[model samples]
Target: MASETIPITVEFTGGLEMLFADQRKHSLSVPAKDERGQAVTVGWLVHYLCVEVMKDPRKEMFVLDGHVRPGILVLINDADWELEGEASYALQARDNILFVSTLHGG
Candidate 1:
Protein backbone atom coordinates (compact mmCIF):
# COMPACT_ATOMS: atom_id res chain seq x y z
CA MET A 1 0.00 0.00 0.00
CA ALA A 2 1.09 3.56 -0.65
CA SER A 3 2.36 5.47 2.33
CA GLU A 4 0.05 7.99 3.90
CA THR A 5 0.78 11.70 3.48
CA ILE A 6 0.28 14.60 5.83
CA PRO A 7 -0.48 18.07 4.61
CA ILE A 8 1.39 20.90 6.30
CA THR A 9 2.26 24.52 5.78
CA VAL A 10 5.86 25.73 5.85
CA GLU A 11 6.81 29.35 6.10
CA PHE A 12 10.13 31.14 5.97
CA THR A 13 10.82 34.64 7.12
CA GLY A 14 13.60 37.04 8.16
CA GLY A 15 15.08 36.60 4.68
CA LEU A 16 15.23 32.80 4.76
CA GLU A 17 12.57 32.57 2.06
CA MET A 18 15.08 33.76 -0.52
CA LEU A 19 16.55 30.30 -0.53
CA PHE A 20 13.23 28.68 -1.17
CA ALA A 21 12.53 30.17 -4.60
CA ASP A 22 11.73 33.51 -3.04
CA GLN A 23 8.52 32.09 -1.64
CA ARG A 24 7.53 32.68 1.95
CA LYS A 25 5.05 29.86 2.37
CA HIS A 26 4.64 26.41 0.96
CA SER A 27 1.84 23.93 1.31
CA LEU A 28 3.01 20.38 0.97
CA SER A 29 1.95 16.83 1.42
CA VAL A 30 4.65 14.62 2.83
CA PRO A 31 4.91 10.99 3.68
CA ALA A 32 3.61 10.16 7.10
CA LYS A 33 6.29 7.56 7.69
CA ASP A 34 9.78 6.76 6.63
CA GLU A 35 10.83 3.70 4.68
CA ARG A 36 11.02 1.87 7.98
CA GLY A 37 7.46 2.96 8.76
CA GLN A 38 8.57 5.27 11.55
CA ALA A 39 6.63 8.49 12.00
CA VAL A 40 8.01 11.43 10.06
CA THR A 41 9.59 14.10 12.17
CA VAL A 42 10.57 17.73 11.75
CA GLY A 43 14.08 16.55 11.01
CA TRP A 44 12.79 14.83 7.92
CA LEU A 45 10.79 17.88 6.91
CA VAL A 46 13.91 20.04 7.06
CA HIS A 47 15.71 17.72 4.69
CA TYR A 48 12.74 17.65 2.38
CA LEU A 49 12.66 21.43 2.19
CA CYS A 50 16.35 21.62 1.45
CA VAL A 51 16.41 18.99 -1.24
CA GLU A 52 13.01 19.35 -2.78
CA VAL A 53 11.76 22.86 -2.26
CA MET A 54 14.75 25.15 -1.96
CA LYS A 55 15.92 26.49 -5.30
CA ASP A 56 18.93 28.40 -4.10
CA PRO A 57 22.31 26.77 -3.87
CA ARG A 58 23.05 28.28 -0.47
CA LYS A 59 21.71 25.38 1.52
CA GLU A 60 24.36 26.01 4.14
CA MET A 61 22.55 29.23 4.99
CA PHE A 62 19.55 27.25 6.22
CA VAL A 63 21.22 24.13 7.56
CA LEU A 64 24.60 23.16 8.89
CA ASP A 65 26.03 19.80 9.88
CA GLY A 66 22.69 18.16 8.97
CA HIS A 67 20.65 20.40 11.26
CA VAL A 68 19.04 23.85 11.21
CA ARG A 69 21.84 26.35 11.61
CA PRO A 70 22.10 28.48 14.72
CA GLY A 71 20.43 31.90 14.65
CA ILE A 72 17.44 30.42 12.86
CA LEU A 73 14.37 29.83 14.94
CA VAL A 74 11.82 27.12 14.22
CA LEU A 75 8.22 27.53 15.31
CA ILE A 76 5.63 24.81 15.27
CA ASN A 77 2.02 25.89 15.50
CA ASP A 78 2.92 29.29 16.92
CA ALA A 79 5.13 27.78 19.65
CA ASP A 80 8.85 27.44 19.76
CA TRP A 81 10.11 24.20 18.33
CA GLU A 82 12.16 23.60 21.46
CA LEU A 83 8.97 23.24 23.43
CA GLU A 84 7.78 20.69 20.90
CA GLY A 85 10.85 18.45 20.93
CA GLU A 86 12.57 20.36 18.12
CA ALA A 87 13.54 18.14 15.26
CA SER A 88 12.15 15.03 16.85
CA TYR A 89 8.64 16.40 16.84
CA ALA A 90 6.36 14.30 14.68
CA LEU A 91 4.59 16.16 11.88
CA GLN A 92 0.82 16.38 12.03
CA ALA A 93 -1.77 17.20 9.41
CA ARG A 94 -2.40 20.92 8.92
CA ASP A 95 0.58 21.73 11.10
CA ASN A 96 2.22 25.07 10.51
CA ILE A 97 6.01 25.15 10.60
CA LEU A 98 7.90 28.39 10.36
CA PHE A 99 11.59 29.16 10.07
CA VAL A 100 12.88 32.59 10.93
CA SER A 101 16.44 33.74 10.45
CA THR A 102 17.99 35.99 13.05
CA LEU A 103 21.36 36.62 11.47
CA HIS A 104 21.86 39.86 9.60
CA GLY A 105 24.80 40.83 7.47
CA GLY A 106 26.03 44.31 8.04
Candidate 2:
Protein backbone atom coordinates (compact mmCIF):
# COMPACT_ATOMS: atom_id res chain seq x y z
CA MET A 1 0.00 0.00 0.00
CA ALA A 2 1.10 3.54 -0.59
CA SER A 3 1.38 5.97 2.25
CA GLU A 4 -0.72 9.07 2.09
CA THR A 5 0.93 12.37 1.38
CA ILE A 6 0.86 15.34 3.68
CA PRO A 7 -0.15 18.64 2.25
CA ILE A 8 1.47 21.74 3.61
CA THR A 9 2.02 25.38 2.89
CA VAL A 10 5.50 26.88 2.76
CA GLU A 11 6.26 30.54 2.91
CA PHE A 12 9.39 32.64 2.90
CA THR A 13 9.93 36.24 3.80
CA GLY A 14 12.48 38.75 5.05
CA GLY A 15 14.56 38.37 1.87
CA LEU A 16 14.58 34.60 1.59
CA GLU A 17 11.78 34.78 -0.99
CA MET A 18 14.33 35.89 -3.55
CA LEU A 19 15.52 32.33 -3.89
CA PHE A 20 11.99 31.14 -4.70
CA ALA A 21 11.45 33.54 -7.57
CA ASP A 22 10.15 36.18 -5.15
CA GLN A 23 7.09 34.07 -4.48
CA ARG A 24 6.68 33.99 -0.75
CA LYS A 25 4.17 31.19 -0.46
CA HIS A 26 3.94 27.77 -2.00
CA SER A 27 1.55 24.87 -1.52
CA LEU A 28 2.81 21.37 -1.96
CA SER A 29 2.62 17.80 -0.79
CA VAL A 30 5.22 15.39 0.50
CA PRO A 31 5.32 11.78 1.48
CA ALA A 32 4.28 11.04 5.00
CA LYS A 33 7.42 9.09 5.71
CA ASP A 34 11.04 9.13 4.75
CA GLU A 35 12.88 6.26 3.11
CA ARG A 36 13.54 4.97 6.62
CA GLY A 37 9.81 4.86 7.35
CA GLN A 38 9.95 7.76 9.76
CA ALA A 39 7.48 10.56 9.75
CA VAL A 40 8.53 13.47 7.57
CA THR A 41 9.70 16.33 9.71
CA VAL A 42 10.67 19.90 9.18
CA GLY A 43 14.21 18.83 8.41
CA TRP A 44 12.98 16.65 5.61
CA LEU A 45 10.90 19.51 4.35
CA VAL A 46 14.00 21.66 4.29
CA HIS A 47 15.73 19.17 2.07
CA TYR A 48 12.65 18.91 -0.12
CA LEU A 49 12.66 22.65 -0.52
CA CYS A 50 16.23 22.61 -1.70
CA VAL A 51 15.86 19.65 -4.01
CA GLU A 52 12.37 20.17 -5.41
CA VAL A 53 10.79 23.51 -4.81
CA MET A 54 13.51 26.07 -4.92
CA LYS A 55 14.73 26.84 -8.45
CA ASP A 56 17.60 29.13 -7.58
CA PRO A 57 21.09 27.83 -7.05
CA ARG A 58 21.50 29.51 -3.68
CA LYS A 59 20.59 26.47 -1.63
CA GLU A 60 23.14 27.40 0.98
CA MET A 61 21.02 30.40 1.80
CA PHE A 62 18.26 28.07 2.97
CA VAL A 63 20.35 25.24 4.31
CA LEU A 64 23.88 24.89 5.59
CA ASP A 65 25.71 21.77 6.71
CA GLY A 66 22.45 19.78 6.48
CA HIS A 67 20.36 22.15 8.54
CA VAL A 68 18.55 25.41 8.31
CA ARG A 69 21.15 28.13 8.33
CA PRO A 70 21.51 30.37 11.35
CA GLY A 71 19.89 33.80 11.33
CA ILE A 72 16.80 32.26 9.73
CA LEU A 73 13.53 31.89 11.57
CA VAL A 74 11.07 29.05 11.09
CA LEU A 75 7.48 29.06 12.18
CA ILE A 76 5.07 26.17 12.25
CA ASN A 77 1.35 26.82 12.14
CA ASP A 78 1.99 30.34 13.37
CA ALA A 79 4.15 29.30 16.34
CA ASP A 80 7.88 29.28 16.62
CA TRP A 81 9.35 26.00 15.39
CA GLU A 82 11.42 25.72 18.55
CA LEU A 83 8.26 25.21 20.54
CA GLU A 84 7.11 22.56 18.08
CA GLY A 85 10.34 20.56 18.37
CA GLU A 86 12.24 22.35 15.63
CA ALA A 87 13.46 20.12 12.83
CA SER A 88 11.93 17.07 14.46
CA TYR A 89 8.44 18.44 14.19
CA ALA A 90 6.36 16.02 12.19
CA LEU A 91 4.50 17.51 9.31
CA GLN A 92 0.72 17.45 9.33
CA ALA A 93 -1.96 18.00 6.75
CA ARG A 94 -2.49 21.65 5.94
CA ASP A 95 0.36 22.67 8.20
CA ASN A 96 1.83 26.01 7.41
CA ILE A 97 5.60 26.29 7.57
CA LEU A 98 7.24 29.63 7.21
CA PHE A 99 10.90 30.59 6.87
CA VAL A 100 11.99 34.15 7.33
CA SER A 101 15.50 35.33 6.66
CA THR A 102 17.20 37.71 9.03
CA LEU A 103 20.28 38.34 6.96
CA HIS A 104 20.78 41.62 5.16
CA GLY A 105 22.14 42.77 1.79
CA GLY A 106 22.43 40.70 -1.35
Steric collisions counted per model: 0, 0
lDDT for model 1 = 0.93
| Candidate models: Cα lDDT each | 0.93, 0.93
- State each model's C-alpha RMSD to the native: 1.3, 1.5
Best-matching candidate per TM-score: 1
Error of 1 at 34 (Å): 1.3
Give the alpha carbon lDDT tens digit for every residue of 1-106 in model 2: 3777988999999999989999999999899989888999999999989999999998999899998999999999989999999999999999999999999675
Off by over 4 Å in 2: 1-3
The residue-by-residue lDDT of candidate 1 on 1-106, one tens digit each, is 4779999999999989888888899999999997778899999999988898988999999999999999999999999999999999999999999999999553
TM-score (C-alpha, index-matched) for candidate 1: 0.95
Using Cα atoms with residue i matched to residue i, what is each candidate's TM-score against the true structure? 0.95, 0.93
Task: Report RMSD for candidate 2.
Answer: 1.5
